[model samples]
Target: MSREIVAGVDGSPESLAAADWAAREARRRRLPLRLVHAWRWEPLEIPLEQDRPSQERTADDVLRKAESTIAERHPGLPLTAEVLQDTPVAALLSTEERAEMLVIGSRGYGAVAGFLLGSYGQQIIAGAHRPVVAVRSRDGAGGGDPEGGVVVVGQLGSADDGAPALGFAFETAAARGASVRAVRAWSLPPLYAYSPTSSALARADEAGGLVPYEEQALREALAPWRERFPEVRVTEHVEIGSAGQVLLGSSGDARLLVVGRRARRGVIGSRIGSVAHAALHLAPCPVVVVPHE
Candidate 1:
């Protein structure tokens, strides 16, 4: 059952865009696509019978239209439509265990202040065990970079700490016949930088004394992936800066931006990592947050 990619749809243009993106990825991965429309039955004033059926019809219509849209774009993509009588977040998270990943529409800066993020949407993204892709599209613009653009992926900590993100990026690039831009952001040790000791001065003479080590670590981190996806041309970027800012800068015109998150919640506590948060809000391309150990 985990061979399928589940996409949440609510008939909104953004959700439709997400369904399209998921369909494209499903086809690329040679997997099935499942579109789920979830809505809770909560009647404030109207009668339960009157409000319930209307919302149910709306849900059916949304799934039907999504299926049509995906079928038209991705012919013969092995698609299925489902309707769930539950909250969006709970419904999607429930399906994550049976799917490879969950794709959901997210409001970007283009949307009203970029502050329209639903608290529940963020919950599902942070709580899911598998990877979750938050998509914001303009007329389905990201069909893959026409000029074989890069797939920017953040390499966190050691090579294995962020293996899931790296592997997902490489596989996606290979599918699109595109290259990968692996970025590793590091800062000089504060204790070593400001100390007025002879050791600090000597190390500073060699161009920060940390760039080469960071470069080597990044290389080692990407080596196994490079071997696994030999056809995915890789360009290593070892920059000295904040992870979020560095990733945002390198995401220009990228087909997809891949980032890592720990399953046990990030520094923000019960939310996505700072880098992933920044990326989902600011990145111009589709962003996938891969959960790792």
Candidate 2:
């Protein structure tokens, strides 16, 4: 069996949280943890010789520090380190090729800064062949809080895309003695009341019929999984707004924001799902992307 949890470390607080989370996950799964830190040296335009030796030494120092930190915290973790000159995204994707799952800090030290996830995390998830877990900071009582917490999956009301991921989410949540939150993002388009189909839609909306129909669809979709994990706490929310925004907003205090991969087919190898993609970019906590499998 393949046994390793891979994560990128760059000495950031969020990445440190990711390291801790990955360590705990590996311990729970009885797998090894591979901690990788990638760095690049960009030569100045003035001349190739200027600051060359110093630059190389600095890169070496950074890599050594990263390796030592992991070794100290997780001794004998079967760890390995890589100092690559390739872009961060490329290095991470390459490292994840053989990993069972790639775990990354949701947010990183980016050019723009703030809570937004760095481009490296997004790109790695978009191209990873294995499962990717985007970890968030230990905000509030979410991290290392307990074994039984909650794993929330954002639902888009479209079973074709959202339904399949519930199985994986439930399995993960159940493994940790956790509950599942199946949420949906709903909205009435501006043309809802003025469209050519408006009359038919209105007729169906009598007694808030349309709302219930949508709710029932989500509930039924989640029923099978709920039945299997009867002990798991289950809750549903139908919020009005952008699917990505709603999911990202609701998961501020969640243990993990579980989502499905959504990307335009044909052009991309592994595309992050619409909601998952957006949430990974702004989630206040970790985000797990459950592929079609």
lDDT of each: 0.82, 0.69
Runs of candidate 2 with Cα error greater than 4 angstroms are 1-3, 40-45, 48-64, 75-78, 106-114, 129-131, 136-146, 189-208, 227-231, 265-274, 290-293
Candidate 1: 10-residue stretch with minimal lDDT = 139-148
Residue 264 lDDT, candidate 1, scale 0-100 = 84
User: For model 2, how does the per-residue alpha-carbon lDDT over 1-293 read when each residue is reduced to its tens digit?
Assistant: 57588877776766766776777676656678877777666666774466757866776776667667666766766766666777778887787656867877765332123246567776787777666887656531124535767778876645766765687678767767788888887777566475656764664465376667567768878888888878788888877788887787677567767887754455545557667767666665567776653
TM-score of each: 0.87, 0.73
Model 2, residue 71: distance off in Å is 4.1
Question: Per-residue lDDT tens digits of candidate 1, residues 1-293?
Answer: 45899999988877888888888888878999999999877778855456668878888988898888889888989999999888888889888767988988876666323324467668987898888888775624346324367899999787888899999999889987889999999877766456656563455455456787777778889989989888889999989999998988888768789999888854666668898888887787778899888
Give per-residue lDDT, candidate 1, residue 12. Answer: 82
RMSD of each: 3.6, 4.9
Candidate 1 colliding pairs: none
